[model samples]
Target chain A: MSRVAAFVFRRKGGKGWHWTDIVTWVWLVGGLFIMFGPAVWLVGSSLKTPAALAEFPPTILPYVTQKVSVEGFDKPFDLYEVTLDDGSKATLAEVRRIGIVSQMVDPKAPGEIIKVNIAQRTPVREMSFATENYTEPFTHFDFFRYLWNSVFVTVVATLITLVVNSMAAFALSKYEFRGRTAAMLVILATLMVPLSVIMVPLYSIVSALGLFNSLWGVILPTVATPTGVFILRQYMLTIPDELVDAARMDKASEWQIYWRIILPLTAPALAVLAIFSVVWRWNDFLWPLIVLSRKELYTLQVGLSIYSGELNVQWHFILAMTVVTMIPVVLVFIFLQRFITTGIAGTGLK
Target chain B: MTIDGSGKTGPRVGEIAMAPVRFAMGLVDAPLRKLQKVAGLGGMATFFLLPNMLIFGIFVLLPFFINFAYSMTGGSALFLSDRSFVGVDQYARLFDCSNYLDPNSCAEDTFWTAVGNTGWFVVLQVTLMIAFSLVTALILNRDLKARSFWRAMFFFPVLLSPVVVGLIWKWILQRQGLLNFGLYGFGFDPYAWLNDRTWSFAAAVAVSIWAHMGFYTLILLAGLQAIPKDLYEAAEMDGTRSMRVFMRITLPLLMPNLLVVIVLVLIRAVQIFDEVYVLTGGGPGTSTLFLTQYIYETGFATQLRNPGLAAAASILMGVVLVVLTLVQLGLGRSSDKNGGRK
Candidate 1:
C-alpha cells in the first residue's frame, strides 16, 4: 500500500516534530478539556457540601471545614487558627460570638474564651467527598421515581416501536398490497413533522383519551416513528424475496415468515433502531412534559429540568441528580458507540 | 422452521433463546394461516401494516391536520368544536406588527422576539456548528491514534438529554459557578454569564454547538473517509497545496453530507427550546427565547393558554421546516444519483 499522507499521520521532521502533529495534539487535548472538563468539575462540585458549593471561588476538589469538640463544650466547635491581640497565634475552637468578634477556646483548657475578630482566624479544612449528595436525593426528592418512570417509558416504547415498525417495514418491503403506496407515502410525508409542530393538537387528543399523566400516554404516541419505519423498510428491501417464498412453500404462516425469516435477517438494522429508540425515548423531554404533569409520572428529563429550573435552586442536589440523569445515556453511548454513527446515517433522525 | 436449514448442528444459542418466541409464534401460527387463507396475500400485508398505520395516523398525521383546525379556531378551549372559529384571525394577530423588524413595535411583541431570536440563532448556530464540525471531522479523519476514542468523546454529548445538557452548562455559567470561580481565581470579577443578555444568547449558541457538533462531525468524517485516497495522492503528485486540494476535491466530495448536516442543524436550531429554556429560561429580558418555547409558553405554561395563537405560530414554524425538508429530499436525491452534488 502507498504510504499514508504525511498530513494524515504524524511525521518526524529533521528537528523535534512536524507542525501538523503539534496542531492536532493541541486541538485534541484542548477539545478534550472543553468537551469533558465541565462534567468532571461538576462531579467534583456535586461531591462538595452545600457551603463549599456556595463559596465564591470554589475548589476543584470538595473540602469541608474541620470542626472539633473541646473538653467542656457539648457541641462541636468549628476549629480555627486564631491570632491573639498580643500577637500570638494558636489553634482555637470557636465557642460563640457577639457582633464581629468570635469567641475562641483552646481544646486543652476550655474554661477561658478569647474574643477575636472573625477576619483574624482561618478555619481548618479537610478534603471530604460528600457521598450524601448522591444519596440524599433518593430520600428527599422524587429522583428514583423519575428514574424508574424514564426506564419504563424507554424500554416499553422501544420494544413496541421495534415490533410495530418492523411489521410495517416487512409489509412495505416484502409484499405487493392495496393502499401500500398510500400508506408508505403518508409515513414518508410526515417524516419531518416533529412533535413540536403538532404538540397542541396531540396534547388535546391525548387529554381526550384520558391518558393525561400516564406513562403509556408518553410511550404509545412515539412508537410509530416515521424514521424507524423508513430505516427498517430500507433495510428489509435488501433481503431476497425467495426467502419468504421458500418459507411459504414450507407451509409456514405469514406471521412465522415475519418472525423467523425476516426478523432475524433484519437484526443489524433492528439493533440500530433499538439503539436509536432507546436514546430518543430516554432523552425525550417535550412530549413527556406535556403528557405527564403529575410529579409521580415525571421522567428523568422532566424531573431534572424541574429541579434545576426552580427558584432558590438547590445546587448540590441538582448537580448530583444531573450527573445521574446523564450517566445512563453516556454509558449507552460508550457501549453502542460503534453502531451510533450507522444509526444516525441510516435514519438522519438526530 | 425447516427452511432455516440450521438444525444440522442441533440447537444453537440463538435457537435456544428463541425457543419461547418460536413456541409463541407456533400458538399464533394456525390462526394466522386460517386468516391468511380467508383474507389472502393482500390482507396479510394489511395486517402487517395496520398497527403502525393506526398509531402513525392517530398521533402524527391526524394531529397535523387537526393542528390547522386548532389554528383556525380561537379560545383557550383545546378541542376544536369547543372553540369558536376565528378563520385566520390568529395568523393576523401574529402578523399585526407595525414594524416586523422591531419586535417592540409589534402587538404580539414576544412572538416577534421569539421569531427574531430563532432567526439569529439558526443563522449563527448552524454556521458555526458546521464549521466546527468540519474542522473536528478533518482532524479525526487523519490517521491518528485513538480516532474512535476521540470521536466518541465528541459524540457523547449528543446522547445527553437536552435537560442534562442545559443543567451542565447552567452550573458552569451561573454566578459563582465553575467558570466564574476560575475567573475569580485569576483575580477577575465573577461575571454573571447567563444573566447578561448578549452573553446568554451567545451561550445558547455555544452550548447548542457543544451538544450537537459531534453528530455532524461524525457525518463529515464519514464523508472525508469516503473520498478516494487516489485523489489526494494525485493532488500530492501534482504538487498541490493541501488547502487548494481541499477546495478543489475535498469540499466538492463532502458537499452532500455537509448539506445534510446543514439542513438537519437548521431544523434543530429552529426548535431550540429545551436546553436554552433550562439555561437562560429565556431570561435577562427575553434575549434568548426561541420559537418552540414561545409556542409552549403560550399554549401550555401560562395560566390561560391561547392554543389558537400557539397553533398559528407552530404552523408558521412547520412551514419553515417543510421547506427545509424539501430541500433535504431534493439534495438527497441528487446526492444519491452522483454520490455527491457535483
Candidate 2:
C-alpha cells in the first residue's frame, strides 16, 4: 500500500512527485499490467465454465448462474430476479422457458407457476470455479503420461548433464592435458549452435541409432551443453589448487580428488547449471517434437502444444494444463530468484 | 583417504547424509588409483573429457557437417545412403528467384517470405526490445520502494515457457478473447487482432518483446548500476541537462552491456519459433512465418517434405547465426581487453 502511495507522491525529497517520478510510476504500473495481468487472467479463465468462457464482453471473474433446489424439481432451477407486473422485482426459481415467457416459481411457495417475460428476468450468478476443467482431462487424455515424460526427461537429463558436463569441466579446469586448448575452443565455438539448426541431421543420427520415439533420444542428444561446461569450468577454476594438491599428497586417486573435493566445492555452480538444465529440458519442444512421434511419449511442453493446436473447443482445459505446466519453474523462481539472478550476474552467463 | 581437517563448521548434516556416497566412492578410489598409476594423469584427463566430447561430437559437431551433406542431396530420405548428392542444387533452388524482394516472384516463395519475415522481425524486435529494456532499466534503477518486488514482477514473464506465453496471449488476443471483450465493453468495435496480416505481424513482434524484454531489462539494469555514481554526480554538479548527461556518460559506458544485449536479442530473434509458432501458427496466410518455423514445417510437418531444401534453408540460417555469434564473441573479447583500461 505504501508502495502505491510512494508511486503516487514520492520524489526528490519534495512533498509531491516530479513529472519524471510520475512517468516512472506510469512505466512501473504499465509493466505490472503487461507482465503480470495475463498470468492472472489465465488462472481466472481456467476456472470459468465453458458457457462462461463464451460470454461477450466477458466477466472479470468466473461466474456461474446461481441455482436453487426447489421443493419439487428434478434438477436444480436457475434462480433469477423477475420484474413483476407491478414493477417490483423478486428472486424466483426459473422452471421453463417457452419463447418470450418463462415459468418461474417461488421456492417458499411451491406448485404455483408465475409467468414472466424472459427479457424481464436476469440470471443470478456467483463467482465459482469449474474444477471439472482440470479433472476432466486426466480421465480422458494422457495428461499424467505427458507430465511423467516431462519430469523423467528433466530429472534424468539434468543428472546426466551434471555428471557429464562436470567431468569435462573437471578435466579442463584441473589438468594441463594434451589438446586442452583445442577441446576448450571446440566446446566454446559451438556454444551458439542451437538444436534448431541441426535438427535435420541430428534426427537422422538419433533414428539411425534406433532411438526414435524414445525419451533417451531427447535426453542423450542435448546432455553435453557447451554453456553448462563453460559455466562449471569457470566456477571450478576458483577452487584453490591446494585442495587438489593435498588430496594427491594423501595418495588419493585423481577420480577421488574430483569426486570428493572439486565436486563438492563446485556445488553452487552445479546448482545453477542443474537449474538451467531442468528448465531447458522441461521447456524443450522442438527437438522432442522431432524425436517423439508417439503420443504417449510427449512431454508436457509437446503435449501442451499438441492440445493447443486442437484446443479451439478445449481452452478451459488447456488453460488449466498451462497453469499446471508453469508451476514447477515458477516455484523454483519464487524461492531461488535472488540466488539465480545473482548467480547469472556474477558469472555473466546467458 | 582424504581427511576432513580443513575447517569444520558444525555437525555438517549434509556431509553425514553423504557418508555412504563417499564410502562407495572410496571403493572405486582404489581401482581408479591403480588405473591412474598405469595410465598417468594426462590419460585420466582424457578419460574425463572423453564422454562429454563424444556426445558433443556426435550430436552437435558431426551433424553440423552432415547438415551440409543433407543440403547438397535432393531426396526425402533421412538416411544419407538413400540420398544422391546433386551438388548445391538445394542452394540453387533457394536462390531460384528472379527478384529477392517480391517473395511471390520466387520459386520457393514461402522460403523467401520466411527470410523477409525473419529479417524484419530481427530488426524490429531487437530495436524495440533494447529500447524498452533500456527504459525499464532506467526506471527500475531509481531507488524505488519495493524495488525487488518490481524487479521480480518485470521478470515474471521471462520464467514462463514459450508455449505458455503463446497460449496466454492467444486467449487474450483471439477474437472474442479478453482484448476484444474489453473493447466491446468500451463501446468500441472489437478488432480481429490476429486474423489480419499487419496486426498479426505487429502482434508477433509485440508478444516476443513482452515475453523476453524482462531478461534484457534485468541485464541492462545491472549495466546501469555498474556505471560509477561519481561520474553522474560530477555531471550533476556541472548542472548539465539530464538528457545530455545520459547521452554523454550513460550511453558510452553502457555500450558494452548494450552490445551484448543487442546480439543476444538478435540471435534469439532470428531463431524465433516456439512462441510465434504457437501464437500465430504461421497465420491466416503465412504472414507470421519466420525462418525457424519455415525450416521445421518444410522438414517435418509438410506433406511434401523437402528434406534437402529444408536442410539448405537451415544451413543458410546457420551462416547468419555464426556471424552473429562471432560478433558477440568479438565484442566480449574486446570488452575484456579494455576492462583494465576502463
Candidate 3:
C-alpha cells in the first residue's frame, strides 16, 4: 500500500480499509454535495432560458431553445427532425402563433409542405448558457455603481477598523494603565449589545451627524468593532514583551514602536481581522438599507435586495447579481482560508 | 560644554552667558516638559485608546443609553425633542396580552407574533444547527479523501453574505425552483415552499442552518481535533464500538465547543433578520417574522415608522441577549479555568 493509504487506513488492523472509513467517505461526499448544491443551482438557474426555467421538471443544465429553418418554411421555427413511417427523415414544426398547426416537410422535396395534426412536438433539450443574465442587470440597473459603492465602503471601513482596533488591542494587551482592566471589560461587554438593539439610536446619531444618506453614515459607526478589538487583543497578548522592550531600548517612541514592531509582529492576526472586516462591511445590509435610500449610494447587498423587490423577482438576474457579489469575498476566502480557519479556531479556544 | 575633537573641558565667560539664555529657553519649556512628564507612560496608553474610545463612546455606549430613553418615549418622531415621554407604556403595550400565551390575543399582535415566532425559531434553529454542525464536524475530522476540500465546501457558505444565501435558497425553494423540479421529476406535486406558512418557516430555519452551520462546524472540528489521540487509541485497543467511543470519549470531551455553539446559535437565531427577511419577507401571514425583523419593520418599514415602540421591542431583545451573552462568557471563563487546571 502507498504511504498515504497506509496512513489513512491506520486503525490498528494494519493497512486495510475499515467500515468506518467507508461511512466517513460516504458522509463527507454527500455532505459536500448538500453544502454546494444550492450555489451550483443558483449559477445554473441564472444561465437558463426563461422557458427552461419555467419547465415542470426543472433542468439542472441551462438550455437554449433554438429555431431551425425547415425546407418548406421561410421563417425559422422550433422543429424536430423526425423519422417517418418509410424511414426517411422529415422536419416537424409546431406553429402556435396561428393556433396549433403542425407542418411536416420532406427533406428530399424542397418545397413540399404537409399539414400534420400532432398534439405535441418532440422535445429537444439543448444545453445553452444565457450570458445575457449576467449583463442584463447591469444594462437595466446601476449595478456597477452599487459594485463601486460596495468596494469603496469595504476598503475604507476595513482600513479604519484595522487601525482603530489594532491600536486599542495594542494598548490593552501591552500596556499597564489605571483603567486597563476596566477598559477591556467595557469593550468586551459591548459585544453583547447587538446592532438591532441600538439601531434606532444609531440611526438618529448618524442623522444628527448629517451623514444620513451618505455612505460615510454607514462607514463611520462601524469602524470600531468590539469583536475585532477582542480578537486582535487575544492574539496580541501572545506576543512576548521583549520585542516591545527592545524597540523602546532603541529610542523608539511608543507610537513608533507600535507602528513598526507590534503591527508587523501581529501581521497574521491583522490579516485575519482585515478579512473579517471586509466581509462584514461588504455584506452589511440592514444598516446600509436604512442609511442609504438613494440609488447612487446603495451597496451591492442593498442593490441585490432592490433587484429582488416584491413585484418582479427576476431570479435569473438576482442569482447572477448574487454570484457577482460573491466573487470578491470568495477570492479573499480562497487566498486566506488557512488564516481564517486558524483565526476562528484560535478565537474559539481562547 | 565639551568639544568632540579639540577637548575643551571648561566653560568660558561667553559660554556662561549663553547658558543663561539656554536656561531662559528651558524656563520657557518648563510647563511643556511638566505636561509631558505628567502624561508619561499612562498618557501613551490614553493616546492609543482615545480614537477607539471616542468612536465607541459615540456609537456604542451613547446609543445604548439613547436606545433606552427612546424605548421609554412614544412617537413617530426620529428626534427625541419631537417625541413625548411615555414611561413604560411602550413596554406595557408589548406586555399587554389578554392571553399572554396566545400571541393573537395581544394588543400589539404583530409584536407578539414576532416574539412567539422567534421563540419557536430559536428552539428549532439552535437544535438542528448544533446537530448538523456536530455531524459535519465529526465527519470532516476523519481521515477521509479530499478533507480540506470538504471542509472548504462546508465553510464557503459561511463566508457568503446572508443576502446571497437567502437569495440563492429562495430561488431554489420557490414553486418552480430546483427543489420542486426534483420533486416533479419523481412525479410529486409542486408545493409553494415560500408562500405557505409552515414550509416558509421551515425554509427559513433550513436556510439559516445552511448559511451558518459551517462556522459552528469549524469550531466543533477544532474541538474534535483537540481530543487526544491516546484516548481513541486505547478505546480501539479494547475493541470498543465506534458509537460508544464517540458518545463517551468524543462527545464528553467536546462539551465546551458544544456549549459555545449552542449559545452562539441561540443568539444568532434570535437575531435572524437578513436571511428570513429577504427569503420570505416575514411573510405568508408573518410566519417567519423574527424579532430583529419586527424591530426593523416597526422602526423603518411601516408608514408609522414608530421608533419608540421599536426601541422598546429592541430593549426587550437586548435584555435577553445580554443575559445570554453573560451566561456564555461565564461558561467560557469556567471552561478556561478548568482547562488551565488540566
| Candidate 3 chain A minimal-lDDT segment of 10 residues | A92-101
lDDT of 3 by residue, B156-246 (tens): 8888898898888888888887888788878989987999999999999999998988889989998899899999999999999998998
Which residue runs of candidate 1 sit more than 4 Å off their true CA positions? A1-19, A83-89, A97-100, A117-119, A345-347, B1-26, B340-342
Q: How would you encode candidate 2's per-residue C-alpha lDDT over A1-350 as one tens digit per residue?
A: 99898776555676665677878989999888888899989998999998888787789889989989998678999999888999998999989899999999998897899999998999999989899989988988899999999999998898789889999999999999779999999999888688779888888999999999999999999899998999989878888888899999998789988888888776667767777788778888888888998999999999899988887788889999998999998897787566556655555665
lDDT of 2 by residue, B45-127 (tens): 99899999999999999999999999999878889889998999889989999999999999999999999999899999999
lDDT of 2: 0.87
- Model 3 bad stretches (over 4 Å): A1-22, A69-76, A82-88, A92-100, A103-113, A118-120, A123-125, A310-313, B1-39
TM-score of chain B of each: 0.92, 0.92, 0.88
Better of 1 and 2 by TM-score: 2
By TM-score, highest first, what's the ranking?
2, 1, 3
Scored against the true structure, residue A322 in model 1 reaches a CA lDDT of 86
| Number of the top-ranking candidate, with DockQ as the measure | 1
Best by TM-score: 2
Residues B71-162 of candidate 1: C-alpha lDDT, one tens digit per residue: 99998997887999989999999999889999999889999999999999999999999989998998998878788899988887888888
User: Judged by DockQ relative to the true structure, which candidate is superior, 1 or 2?
Assistant: 1
Per-residue error for B338 in candidate 1, Å, reads: 0.6
In every candidate, what fraction of the native interface contacts is reproduced? Answer: 0.68, 0.63, 0.61
Query: How high is the lDDT of residue B38 in model 1?
Result: 96
DockQ of 1: 0.50
